[model samples]
Target: MPELFHKVLKAFSSMKAGVLLLALLALFSALGSTLLPDSFNHLILFNILIIILFFNLSICTFNRCRRIKRLWGAGTGIIGGLRQWSLIILHIGVILILIGGMINNWFGESATLRLAEGEQALIAQDKSGVGVNIQLEGFEIELYENSMPSQYLSHVSLYKNSKLEQQSTISVNHPLRYEGIKIYQQSYGNLVEVETEGQGQVDSSTVLEGQILEIADSKWQVKVFKYVPDFDLAYGMESKSLQPNNPRVIYSLYQDKVMAGIGAAPLGEKIEIASGYYVEFKGIKPYTVLKVKEDPGLPYAGAGGILFMLGVVLAELKIFSKPGQGNGNRKAVVE
Candidate 1:
């Protein structure tokens, strides 16, 4: 075992080892992305493993090489007192980031809940129901001068067991955090027209100018994501039309088997397909999606970063020049 360790150390101390390890890590990262259901776990584990390997290789190489020691001293203030301290600091930083990511990935909790105005919902699955409940007061979408969406906001209040905890606003990129729950303003939808026509009882009946439907039933729920009018069609590519006066919705319907969706140009044009019933453009109402998440490992990651930086300073501040005198920047060779 010791002999094997020596051989491994010798290989890792070489440039070839660094190159090979980097290549392997890159390949594993790419492969990890394509893995199903087990992505975060595998990716985090691989990341930490590679960091350890790199640290070992760096330490071994630094200990064996004199030039490495001088470079480490030149790089940081604290580790600068010792030979190869910069290498150690650099290794520590890599380890910190890896560990941070691992903790964040493993312990992070995320969920999503839909609530209408005056509706309150708890954030997670708990038997005790001891989680925060968020009440959706109102939702709005603001457009830029060019009519493009500039911002989306959700007006909400958080409560814990009937007690008003806080009133907060959430927006894209800005999340609201309370009681270990983070709510992200993910997306929004507008009011749309629903035209429902049934067979037999309401055969050949078209109910245009219908209001939006926001109820979940045994089948699929309907929601209006976006509408575009004056849609244009280019060659080969799917066309887009978003003239408000003649709006077309990019809508989706999620079901158990079929995930049916349509980018209905001019809003409601019937595409003939065999389904349960005929399709219609239902009414539109505002829809807001909130992403809730909690992660316990954030502090550790932060601490690691600070330690890594300190290590860097320590490694660079310490310098030794061959036990000889130096003329300004030039070291005098001791005979």
Candidate 2:
């Protein structure tokens, strides 16, 4: 058993083994990234291979140092002791990091809120059993020179059940965190605006205006606002630019009676009135989208990574100690 340990250690402690491990890690990462969804089984196998590599390296470092106390110098003795301790720490750290990653990937909780101005919704579901509600006071998007999105801004308040908690303005990359919930701005769009103008001999005029709450699996639904031909506007006496083909309606979408979006669009066009809200095709302004997350295992992963690196450094030192030349007993041992 000791002989086998020595041999295994010798192989693992070799500079060649170190180089090979680096190459293998790189290759595995590349392959994992390139694997198609169809190749998920292959990807899982590769992930297992990586974990085995980590564990094997730790074991080998320990086995290699078992007989090093007999070397002819203090350098070899000290390095052997350090390698033994580092091997243990490295093994434990790798196990923790791997377990934490798996737990986070499969069990993490998340929710999406379709918030309108001055509206609130409870973010449902949490693995830790915590509940949170978020109120969106106002939401706005800014545009760049060519009308691409520049930033998203959301004024929000947080509550726990019925108690008011915290409030802040969230933007792209800047999330409002209350308790463990992270509210990230993922994306935004023109929640269509629909209206009817010039009620001149129209066949069926039931202006259905609302936001397409979501789009998934080729299915769509819109929250309908009341039907109106000449929807009253807060601005100047509703522009009378009524065209036979294109008519404009000026009304805003409200989640809780606050404007989520505002614009004017032609009525009865399949494109405009197709989805939830129908509005003129004004370019969407970029909103500051933010993503929120609460990763309980992130700190553990970071610590494990750091400890694993330290173990590698210690293991490297153990291998490079040159055995002293002796007068009568000098020999090249396998380990």
Candidate 3:
């Protein structure tokens, strides 16, 4: 029984066992990447590899710790002790990183929110349930010359239990964090607000272009034909110069299967077509797209990364330094 236990320990602590486990892990990882297997299959493979590596690392670390203890008892000096300790620390850091990755893969959450200025919405966790409230205070789009979008900005406020907790601006490469959730600016779009009035009744609608809306008791079908950020008329043809200085929309109005009018309506302007019936463009608002993420294991991963780097530096220094001069001719051997 004693010999069998010894053999089992030796097998698990051997470098050959570590190498075999690593090779198998690499093979499965490569296959997963190339075949693009289902997410479940990939997860199973990853878990199996992690389990094998975890046991192998535990046994190896235990054996190394015992060996180092014996060396220290035999009066090995400070440098040799430092070298062995650094290697152990490095292995522990790698294990922490793997654990952190597993935790993040299984438990992290992400969602997207589309909000217009002054709009409030509940932030959901994986679309499951509302976790918090977020209000879009403002949205801005920076444009370059020739009217191309350069950057998107969203100023938002976070609320918890109906009380405001934080307010911040998020943009490309700039993120806001609240209670372990990170919010990033993703995209922006234009929205048009339209209102129609007839016969002492008022109807309001908000839509994007290419959408058809019925207002004032379904008698009038309004279709937004085109939207121009900058409207211009040249040579009797409508032209949009692509600058957002003068936003307008070309809309078509129909009443009882007959085209009433087709014309351009500028922002904040009202056009009367048939007596008391009129359409107004209430201007455009920028809607912002935000990506929210929550990963609890990120801090663990960061700490592991820092420790791994420090261990590497310490190990390298010990390796390159003069061997016998440091600590009484005792050399540390790292596997």
Candidate 4:
């Protein structure tokens, strides 16, 4: 039993075993990325491979450390010592990175929050058993030429127990962090509010463009044909433009299956029709989409990355003199 245990340890600590494990891990990772829905069997296989790789890496690093100690004791000089230490650090850094990734995949939390101005929501409602409230103060969008979106910004505030804690504007690539959670601005959209009054009744509905709405107990139905951030008239016909300078909605009124009238109404304006019905296009409200995430292993991954770079730098440092040259003229070889 003792010999068998020793053999198992020796085999796992070998360079060949480490390379084989790495190849298997890469194969499974590629397969997982290409397969849809990620089968349970594949996930189990990948996790098992990771576990084996972890054990193999730990054993190999231990063996290398022991060898380095022996070499240092025998006075193999500083160059050899530095080389061995660099290799050991590189291996340890890779192991930490793998461990960090596993921890993030298994325990991290991610969720999306869609909020209009002055709206608030609780984060991680289904996991972690902690409630963090996030509120949207405002949302802004910058438009470039040709009416394309240049950037999106969301001004947000954090609350704890109904008390304000933090406030910041989060944009793409700029995330807001509070209490271990990061909120990133993901997207934005417009919400249109329409109000109609006819026959001693008032009805209101909030809708998006291209949505059909039925007025309360009336034969008239309205469909939002299109939304124009800037309303214009071209070639004697009403046209919609993308600039948000003057926002308007082009609506189609239908009377029981027959198109009655099509009109362009600006936001906050009331338009009266010949059929004794009045419609008001209330102002548009901006809705912001935010992605919230909490990853406890991010710091570990960051540290591993720094250590990996440092190891590469230290390993390439030339401390040994050439056979015929002195140490004063030693050249550094960077790989």
On TM-score, the candidate that comes out on top is 4
RMSD of 4: 6.5
For candidate 1, give the lDDT: 0.58
TM-score of each: 0.60, 0.50, 0.63, 0.69
Q: Residue by residue across 25-133, what tens digits does model 3's lDDT show?
A: 7787788767764343338767777777877877777777898899889887666777777777877776777677667767876778889888988874335454678
lDDT of 2 by residue, 31-117 (tens): 656765323323566556555565665565555455444453445444445555565566556756755554444454555566655
Indicate the residue-level lDDT of 69 in model 3: 96
lDDT, model 3: 0.75
**How high is the lDDT of residue 121 in model 3?**
84
Ranking according to lDDT, highest score first = 4, 3, 1, 2
Query: Model 4: which ten-residue window has the lowest total lDDT?
Result: 326-335
Candidate 4 achieves a global lDDT of 0.76
- RMSD for each model, in Å, please? 8.2, 11.4, 7.5, 6.5
* Candidate 1 lDDT over residue span 121-149, tens digit each: 87753468576678999987777776667
Model 1 residue 305 CA deviation in Å: 2.3
Better of 3 and 4 by TM-score: 4
Better of 2 and 3 by lDDT: 3
Ranked by lDDT, the better of candidates 1 and 2 is 1
